[model samples]
Target chain A: MTSRRIESFVGHGALILGALIALYPFVSIVRHALGPAAGSNAAGPFTLENFTRAWVGGGFSHSLVSSAIVAVGVVVVTGAIASLAGYAMAMLDVPWRGAIMGVLLIGLVLPAEARIVPLYDMFEGWGLLNTYWAIILPQIASSFSLSTMWMTTYYSALPKELTESAAVDGANSWKAFTRIVFPLGSSALATLSCLIFLYTWNEFLLALVLLPQNPAVQTAPLSLSFFAGAERNTQPEVIAAAAVLVALPVVIAYAFLQRRFIQGLTEGAVKG
Target chain B: MSLGHRDVAAPEKRRVAGRALRSRPATRRAHRLRTTAWLYLLPGFAFYGAFSLWPLIETFQYSFYKWDGITAAKWVGLKNYIKIFTSEDALSTFAHAFTFILFYAAIPVVVGLVIVGVMTRVRIRLLGLLRTVLFIPQILAMVVVAVAWRWIYAESGPINAALEAIGLDSWTRAWLGDFKTALPAVGLIGTWVMYGLCMVLFIGGSQKIPRDLYEAAKLDGAGPFQEFMAVTLPGLRGEISVALILTVTAALRNFDIVWNTTSGGPGNATLIPSYLIFEGAFVTRQVGYAAAASVVLTTLILLLTGGIQALLRQRK
Candidate 1:
C-alpha cells in the first residue's frame, strides 16, 4: 500500500513540475508586461499602458492586421487545394499517384532553406517582393504538402460505402464529394484548419525574408522582433507587452480549440 | 458515427456500382475519370511546382554558377560545394547545427521516455489540461518564446537576480552573451519547446498498448522499470520515430530562435547553417555560396530523416 502511494505521489510530482516549468515563462512575461513601464518589478501593480505603447509605438496594430490577412489568405487557398487533391488521390482514379506522392514527399521532407534563395530571386525578378502575394503564394505552395497529406489520410480512413452508395444513386464524383465526403470530413477539416492557422500565424522566417521592405505586409512576429530589439534596454515592459500581443490570437485560438490542435498533431502517430 | 453501418453495407454498394460501371464503356469512363482527377490535382500541383519544385531545382542550378543575382553568371562547378567541405568556418556552422540535435532531439526523447516510465506506474489526472499547457510552447511564435527567454537570461533577469540573492554572483554572467554558454543556452531553449511534444506523442502512443500485456507483466511479478522496458518502450517505436524526425528537423533548420535571441553573435558562437546561409545570400552577397550551403543543409536533413526511418523500420 505504501509503495503504491509513493508511486502515485512521484508520478504526480514529476508531471506537475514539468507543467509548471512550461507555464512559468508565459506567466512571467505577462506579469512583466503589466508592470511599470520603466522598471522590471515582475509582479508590480498591473497596468494596461504598456499594451497601448506597444500597439501604437511598436506599429503592432498594422502588423497584426497584416498577419491576419496573410494567415487567412493562405488558409483558404491551401484548404481548397488540399481538399481537392486529397479527394482525388484517396478516392478517384488520379493518374501518376506514385509520382505525385514522390513530389509531395520531397516537399514535405525538404527544409525551407533549400529553396528560399531561389524563391527570393524569382519573386524579385517578377517585382513581387514586398507584396502580400510574395508571402501568401509561397506559403500556400509549401503548405500543400502537409495539408494534402493530412486530408488524404483522413479521407482514406473513411468507409468506402459512403462514396459507393452515392455513386449507385447516380451522383457524380463532384456531387458525392460536395454532399457527402466533405461534410463527413468536418472534424478532419477543422483539425487541419487549426493546425494551418497556428502555423501561418506563427510563421517568422518567411515573413522576415520576404516582407521586410513593406510595413503593410510585415507579420506580427517579425515586427515584434524589431520592436523587442530596439526597446530591450529601455522598455522591457513594452517589449513584454508586444510579445503578449503577438502571441495572443493563437493562444486564444488554442484555448478554445485545444482538442482539435492536439488531434491534428497526434492523429498520425496514434493511428500508426 | 455511421461508419459502423457503412462498413457492413460497403461491399453490396460497391458491387452495385461495379455492375452499373460495367454497363458503360469502361475504358472511356476510366479515361474521363482520369482526366477529371487530373483537373482536381492541377491547381495544387501547379502552385507547388512553380514555388516549391522549380525553386528547389533552381537552387541546385544556381549553386554551380557564380552570380550576385545581377551580373552575368560564371559557371564554377563544384567550387561552391568544395568550399563548404574545406572551409573551417563553414564546416563549424554545420557542426553547430548537428550539435543542436543532441539538445533538441536526444534530450527531448530521453525526457519523454523518463516521463513515460514514470507514467506507467500511476495514472495521471487532468491529463488533457496538462497536455494543453505543455504543448503551448510548440504553437507560439518562436520570436515570442525567444523574447520571453531573453529577459529570463538577461543580466538583470530572474537568473541573475536569484544568483545575487544566493551570493552566487560569480555564476551569474549573461547566459546568452557568454561564448561558452551561448550555444548550450540556446540549445536548452529548444529542449524546453520540444520535450512537451515528445511527451504528448509518447502518451498518445501508450494508450494504444493492450491492457492484456500489462496484466501479463504484473502476473509475471515484473517491477515497474522492467514492465516499462518490456512493454511501454516497444509499443512507442512509431511515435518515437515521428518525434525524432520532427525534433531533429527543427534542430537542423533552427533559425528563428537563434535569429530572435542571439543572431549568431558573441563571435559566432551560436552560428548555424541556416543563419550562415541567410547572411551569405543577403547580407554578404555570396549568393552561390549560400545556395551551396542550403543544398548541403537540405541533403543533411533528408539523409538524417531517411536514416531514422530505416533504423526504426529495422527494429520493427
Candidate 2:
C-alpha cells in the first residue's frame, strides 16, 4: 500500500510534467502571441496591432486564399484520380494490375525532394513555374498511395454481392461503380480528401523550391517561411501571430474530423 | 525454387487459356470480366503513366548526367554518386539523421511508454482534454511549429526571459543560433511535434488489450512495473513498430522542421540529407547529383523499413 501510494504520486507528477513539456512550445508561442511587448499594462496588450499586422502585414490574407485554392485543387484532383485508381485496384482482374501496382509502389518510395530537381526542370520547360498548377498538379499526382490505399480498403471490405447484383440488373460497370460503390465509399473518400488537403497545405519544400521568389503564389506554410528567412531583422511578435494564424485552420479542421483523422493516419500506416 | 518457376509458368497457362476463351462459354464470361476491369483501370493508368512513371524513369536517367537543371548534360556517369559517398558534407548529413534519431525516435518512444504505463494505473479525469492538448501540435503545419519554436529560442525571447527569472541567465543563449546547441534544439522541436503522435498510438493500442491481463497480474500481486512489463509493453508492440517506422522515415526525409527552424544553420550543424537534396537540386543546380543521393536515401529507407516490418511482425 505504501509503495503503491508513492508510485502513484510520482506517476501523476511525471505525467503532468510530461504533458506540460509536450505542450511547452505551443503554450509558449501562445503566450508570446498574446503577451505585451516588454512592460505593457494590459495582459495581451500591443496585440490588435500584432493581429492586424499578421493579417495584413505579411500579406497573409492573399496567401490564405492562395493556400485554399492550392489545397482545394490538390484535394479534388487527388480524390478523383485516387478514387479511380483505388476502385480499379479493387476490381483486380484488370490487365496490368501487376505492372500498375509495381509502378505506384515505386511512386510511394519516391520522396518529393528527390523529384523537385526534375520537376522544377520539367515545370520550367513548360513555363509553369510560380503557378498554382505547378504545385497542385505534382501534389495531386503524389496522392497515388492515399487514393489507392483508401479505395482498396473500402473495396476490400465492400460486399461483392452488391456490385454483382447491380451489374445483373442491367447496370454497366461504370454505372454500378458510380451508384453503388461510390456511395458506400463516402467515408473513405472524406478521409482521403482530408489527407490530400492537409498534404497540399503542409507541403513546404516543394512549394519553397518551386515558388520561392513569387510571394503572391505562396501557400500558408510557404508564406510562413518569410518569418524564418534568417534575415536577422524580423520581429518575434509578428512571427508569433503569423504562426498562430497559419495554425488556426488546421486545428479547426482537425476538431471536426479528429476521429477520422486519427483513424486514417493509424490505419493508413498499417495498410501502407 | 520449382514453385517460383511454376508460378511464372502458370501465368503463361493463364494466357493460353485466355486465348481459348470463345470455345468455352465460361472462359468467355471470365474474359468479359477481364475486359470490364480494363475499362475500370484505364483512367488511373493513364494518369500514373503520364505523371508518375515517366517522371520516375526520367529521374533515374537524370542522375547519370550532370545537368545543372538547365545547361547541357555532361554525362558524369558514376561521379555524382561517388562524390556523395566520399564528401564530408554528405557524411555530415547522414550524421544529422542519426543525431535526430536520438530525440526524434528514442525520446518519444520512452516518453510514450511511460505515459501509457501511468495511464493504466491512474483513473485520471479530463483525459480527453489531456489527449487533445498533446495532440494539437501534430495537427498544426510544420512551418507554423518550426517558426513558433524559432521565436521561443530567440536571444531575448521567452526562453531566455524564463532563464533570467530562474537565475539561469548565464545558461541561456540564442539556442537556434548557437552553433553547438542548434542541431539538438531543432531536434527537440521534432520531439515536441512527434511525441503527441506516439502518445495517441500508444493510448489507442493499449485500450484494446484485454483488461483481464492486467487484472490477472494485479491478482498475482504484481506491481505497476511488472504489470506493465508483462501486459502493457507486449500489447503496445504493434503500435511501437508503427511509431518507430513513421518517425524513423520522418527523421530521414525531415525537411520542414530543420528548414524553418535553423535552415540547417550556424554553419551547417544541422544540414540533413533532405536539405542536401534540396540544396543540390535547387540551390546548387546539381539536379543529377541530388537524384543520386535521393535514390541512395530512398533505397536505405526501403531496406531499413522493410527489415523493421519483417522483424516486428506487427502486421498480419
Best-fitting candidate, measured by TM-score?
Answer: 1
Which pairs clash inside model 1?
Answer: none
Stretches of candidate 1 off by over 4 Å are A39-44, A268-272, B1-24, B314-316
lDDT of 2 by residue, A22-59 (tens): 67777677767676544444554545566566788787
Model 1: per-residue Cα lDDT over B119-140, one tens digit each: 7666778898889988988888
Docking class of 1: medium
Best by DockQ: 1
Cα lDDT of model 1 overall?
Answer: 0.86
lDDT of 1 by residue, A129-154 (tens): 99899899989988888888888888
Worst 10 residues of 2 chain B by lDDT: B1-10
Evaluate all candidate structures by whole-model CA lDDT and list the values in order: 0.86, 0.76
Off by over 4 Å in 2: A1-16, A35-46, A96-102, A230-232, B1-23, B121-124, B215-226
- How would you encode candidate 2's per-residue C-alpha lDDT over B79-113 as one tens digit per residue? 88899899999989988998888888889988889
User: In candidate 1 chain B, where is summed lDDT lowest over 10 consecutive residues?
Assistant: B1-10
